[model samples]
Target: MSSQKMRTAQIVEYNKPYQLCERPTPVCGDNDLLIQVHAAGFCHSDLQVLHGQFPAHLPLTPSHEPAGKIVQIGAQVQGSWKVGDRVGVLNFKNSCKSCVGCRQQLRRRHRTDPRFCQSREMAGFKHDGAFAQYMLADPDTTVHLPEKVSFEQGAPLMCAGATVWGALQKLKPDVQPGEAVAIVGIGGLGQLGVQFAKAMNFRTVAIDNRDEGRKLSMEVSEKLKPDLVVDSSAPDASDKILEFTSGEGLAGIVVCTDSIQANAWSLEQLGNGGVMVPVGLPKEKWQFDSSALVFRELVIKGVYVAGTEDVQEMLKVVAEHDITSHITMLEFDDIPGIVEKYTDKAMKGRLVVKIA
Candidate 1:
């Protein structure tokens, strides 16, 4: 247990910057766990929060993706999770179980009481997140970090990994073991998506624009043995993807980045009856060709943060496959540098903080 209260990063007003201040340790209620944050992943999501783009509570801590060991528990938690269990924190701090998105009330607040939804408090965004030394979590949403996994490897998975994994699973429902699963973009979410696609036995393809992005993406394909890796910036990148699929078109494409032009080009690259699932959020509008969809019968869908069932399946898939993220570990002081210096270059291969 900690000796005293903790210091946390808070954003008191919109676009006003963040503040680090000391505050009393939160009480770990019965259904919750007090995590002594060993590492927290500074995300682009946090950037949105800092800009006040995230739709959430104010005067809240903004670090969400986190991993740490349990230091306390509330009275109502009955899981095997204990004070010493290592766990990964999720983004949906408290997803109202009654809400349609949380899981049709599936990750229900109280299993017996449908009226009582699970009150999972998201670290950083919804409440004071993992930008501090400690975080509060619900056993229902927190994934138990494996003994073999380092704190840094699991931190980003709490958010970035889960979001992409969730999208990939939705795109590939019953594909043959070796069918092609293409992922667009190789940033935070795409990198994990590429790895998970390969790990799940799909013929994985990694696509990106920047040379460095392509270089980093290939690391997963090279090490994990993906079927193909293409830089979408290439003059004939669309045709290259077509070549990999044997002119039959990919079984499914998960567009993890929000570049509208890139995604539209990706749609063009799709073969007959292909599906495009978009995960990234863009500020601008996206235009689609109705004529092409009508002729080819293409399918397009937009995915949200993630469903709770998505979380459950991802935790299992990550565990069963023994997937370890490629992360660059940093200390707490790197936050400002991440925002100011490396905003665009930051991707899945690196985690910007080791909070403990």
Candidate 2:
């Protein structure tokens, strides 16, 4: 029997529950590496895929934000990522490696190069993923983790954290130290966003409505010493932003919440030319008047997860600045309940599932 038949997660449809079963441990392709997942975070994105918001090949294994140890590699893969090396997984699947989009975004280093688009395949979305005991990844596309970080702490950095990093970098180029920046929805992605933004020398502020989440946000803020913190639940949250900015307006705002209304509210609160970057893809269209964007001279853009190179550079950034995520660990089989528990509003912070 093929070795892969020893361990795997069975998936029948995009909307169905994930079933755990024995299958061969997946093998690494010529450009790939075989990973033994020690921990894979249950991202909200996974829940989205479960509900069909994100398309996937039927019977697909669903997981992207994973951290683990590398056990084997295909020929031509290098960079000292040998067996037993710590690693983190990013959300991007393989791109054509030659298409414009792939060149521009598949690998962060290729963002400036116009010749690198196109990918051969994708993981989680286009093929099987880390929901199983083993997953195959292209060596060119994986993120290496440092020894200092634990598996759970490194899990969300693979996806949620990378998404936020990409969004924040897009907003604050040469981010002025102490500039005020706001992070919407202090959960899985937002929590890490707060830490990274604060580390970048920006005065990070987190906006969320849940009392527990708000408390968590404040707790993180206290550790980082953001210039100001506000509760989205307050009737006058907008006023609070106004007060905090002293009427000058925020330097930049990232709408991490999935609520279109909250995103629209961000535009109104923006200072002249303030950039509003959306890291979350709401189910429906972004509800807002086109005219609102033109008059304010606002720049609104959305970011997909991130590219291979972005993962590498981001790791260096995280290490140099000491950024990390608030993660909760569960067994590999806990995926079903993990997805079921995330109501539209109750879920916050990243949940890492142990796969070993």
Q: How high is the lDDT of residue 346 in model 2?
A: 54
**Taking the tens digit of each residue's C-alpha lDDT, what string does model 2 give over 1-356?**
12546555656766677877776777677767888888877776677777777665677777777788888877977677788889987655545656667555546653332123354555665577777777887676677897777788887788787788888888856346687888887777777777878877787777877776666665563556455667776888878888888876777888888888888777776776777888777778887656757786777866766666776777887777667676667776677667666663555567778887
Give the TM-scores of the predictions, in the order they appear: 0.88, 0.89
> Measured by TM-score, how close is model 1 to the native structure?
0.88
lDDT for each residue of candidate 1 in 1-356, tens digit (9 for 90 to 100):
44478877677787765666777787777677888998888777788888878677777877778889998988888778777888886766544655554465455433321113356555576568888888788666677776666788778887888778767766655455688888888777777787788877888888887766666666653546456778777788768877888888787788877888877877776667777888877899887788777898888876655644566567666666666666777667655455654355544465647888
lDDT of prediction 2? 0.73
Highest-scoring model, TM-score: 2
The whole-model lDDT of each prediction reads 0.73, 0.73
How good is model 2 by TM-score? 0.89
